[model samples]
Target: MLLTLIYLIASVTFIVGLKMLSNPATARNGNLIAAGGMTIAILGTIFLYEEDGQKLGNYGWIFGGIAVGTLIGFLAAKKVKMTAMPEMVSLFNGMGGACAMLISIVEFDHLFNKDSGVNFEWTAYPPLSALTSDSFFISALPMGQLLIILLGLIIGTVSFTGSMIAWGKLNGKVKDFSFKNQQVLNILMLVLIVAAASYLLWYCNQVGVKINVLTGMDNTNLPTESFFTNVKIIFYGLFVLSILYGVFFVLPIGGADMPVVISLLNSFTGVAAACGGFLYDNKVMLTGGILVGAAGTLLTILMCKAMNRSLANVLIGSFGGNKATGGGGAGKDQGTYKEISITDTAVVMAYANKVFIVPGYGLAVAQAQHVCHELEKLLESKGVEVKYAIHPVAGRMPGHMNVLLAEADVPYEKLLEMEHANEEFSTTDVVLVLGANDVVNPAAKTDPSSPIYGMPILDVELAKNVIVNKRSMKPGYAGIENDLFFQPKTSMLFGDAKKVLQDLVGEIKNL
Candidate 1:
């Protein structure tokens, strides 16, 4: 009863924490509350959980493993740079999948070895087996348990391998490699996994009668030796096939779609974890898993909608793999982009009635969020209204810019979404784009043939003056040239994001 009460508290805390996370004002506190609840849950499990009236032993090994994992997780979180946070999240999520997979493996071994203190009777029903005078039958395995095991195996393996592939792509360790038949190969592998799992379950049910007869053999202590051998072979085959399916599942997806893929894989891991909870009859684990699974799924759907693409298209089409072929209005005949001096840019921003700052991946790479915030405060002090324009998919992941800006103590109210920022651009005097490319490119609006066409973008061109800070004119991750750079109203401010922001801040202060 005490264990049940503790689990209830943990589950409630998880719900409350999740609710709080939706708003930036309470997010940090929400994280802490959730962590505290998890701590309580762990303590309750270690001290009070029992299996068939037997307590778990080996405290030394258990505590040692926990210590090592905690230390490693702490150090990794501290050392990972903001730019690498996406890959870090993928790596950690993959570890969660691995844990669920291992749990299924251990439970399967325990059941097969008859070490779990539960009695099993495998009985075959009609239509599945025929009755014969000489034939022997045993009760069928528990269908619920078997289903949970299979689900945990399949979903966990897929999450693990898919997340690893995402990590590789984000870190540039793996290139986008796809063939004409890539989608076909992925579909084939998925079908094979389903077929293999079905066959294994069917074979297990059928082999029970043969094993029953073998159990009656004279002078044999364990008569089901062949049963274990055959089942082990089938299990291993299913495991291998599932892993292969996961690899192919994410291989054909392009870089731009990674945020959605990451969320989808996260949902897979959550569902797999829920299977573990069901297998163990743990209520807290079940609740937590359900929450994560539902939230990740919703987030994935939302991200797909934001991109104006279907989830099926994202999985099957290689949208970002090829270099952009359409030039939009970025033809050479367009006037050469003019570079603006820091002093001139600073004077314009200082005198402007309203200023908008747009951030992107380059800002993350240059670790300029803090300095950028400094610039916002400086401009606001001069009675100029400053606001931040954030795109839904600005960085490698969703909410990337929000997190970075929050870390720098930027006010939540000042951060504006794409639509809100666009509405204000026409009234704004100057728009400062900090290391952003594709999100502000006019080609998305003007060129129907452009690769990024149909995607929502910031209308920075609508502002009276636009200044873009970039180290070079290199194309963005989508490999598309930005037509906004060639616009008459746009002026390139060539420098590293951090250096330019610092120089701009200094120049503004001097004025």
Candidate 2:
């Protein structure tokens, strides 16, 4: 009972910590609080619980597993480069998925091995003595929870693989936005797996874990079958199907929708964890899973909203949509394309009184956030006022650019949201547009023909001088041309984001 009180306190801390995380100002503190709660929970599991009460067998294996996992997790967290953040996130999500699925597998195993305390015998089974016996599942407990658990396992497994695929695509492990015949394969596999799971469930109900045989009128028994045996077979089949489903589900999704897909996959992992909690009646698992699931879902929805898209549309994999056909007319015509050499452009920027740095998805792709932050400090040293203009939906996900900047130890107050910075853009002597494209394009507000017309954008064009960095005249993730590139106020600094920034840094110092 005392241990239960300790568990309750730990759970409360987890809840309160999560609540604190909702605000950006408090997020770091919230993470620490949550970590403290988890520590307490782990300690309670290891030391406070009665030996017989805890069902987990073999303490040696448990301790060994914990040690190994902790070592790996710590190493990965410490050593992983910021460029590999997407992959790191996917790996974490996969671990969560595996944990959830393993819990479900244990439950399933218990149900088949009726000797376990986790299993409850069906009252429908025959025997006069059994009829008189009392048990938990004898009447009202909804067995639908088992089905939900299985579904969660399948979905979670798929989500895990999908997220990994997304990470690969982002990192160029696989080519970006390449279409394959993977959609058809996913649909077919989903149907077949669902049918198999359904059949297994139905078989369990009909046989009730008993050895059953078909009998003729003369009572001659045919071949007998055990429900448990079939369940083992079905389980292996489910595992295979899960792997295939994961691969296919992610194969068709393109770069534009990858962030949304990642969020959706995270939600799946949470739902799977919640299902495990429901299966085991573990309150902590339920609470943690529900919180993560809700947060991930909300983030996914918000990303979709920011893109002016629906979740369904993203899943269908349009992937930033097609590039706009025909040239950007009136806007392009209004401005004379002034191409300046890197040396000349750098000199102008170096002498600027004030420079507002605008970062976007490309900056993230190049893993240049830290470098950009360093550049800002260097400029500040030279008496330039450096502020960051942040768009609401900058980078691959909401708060993505902010996270990168924050990771670089940039002061939160130094970042200005769109509305706050838009009014000041005109007065800014130099606007350093770092690897950003569509998010800062004014076409969203001014052109009715633009695909992104309904979306809001940063007002980078209002600046007197704009220095744009790019590798090509190629469109952004949206595949749409940016009018800002052609503007007289803007000069293109074409190269790898990191290299260009480095060169600019050198040039600023030289000046």
Best by TM-score: 1
Per-prediction TM-score, please?
0.87, 0.84
Q: Write the per-residue lDDT of candidate 1 for residues 1-511, one digit (tens) a residue.
A: 6888999999998999989988778978988889989999998889888888877788899999999999999999999977788999999999998888888888777766675433465433545346453434553465567768988998999999989999998988988878777777888888888888888777666534332333454221232667667777878788898888888888878877899999999988989989988998999989999899999999999998776667887787536443434554445465578999999999999999999999998898899999999999999999999999999988878889988998899998999999999999999999999888988987777788776777799999999999999989998766778878888899999999999999999999999
lDDT score of model 2?
Answer: 0.74
Q: Write down the lDDT of every candidate, Cα atoms only.
A: 0.84, 0.74
Candidate 1 Cα errors over 4 Å, as ranges: 113-139, 209-227, 321-336, 446-451, 509-511
Model 2 stretches with alpha carbons more than 4 Å out: 48-55, 113-120, 123-142, 177-185, 208-223, 226-230, 320-336, 365-367, 446-451
lDDT of 1 at 266: 95
Ten-residue stretch with the least lDDT total in model 1: 214-223
Top candidate (lDDT)? 1
Per candidate, the number of residue pairs that clash is 7, 0
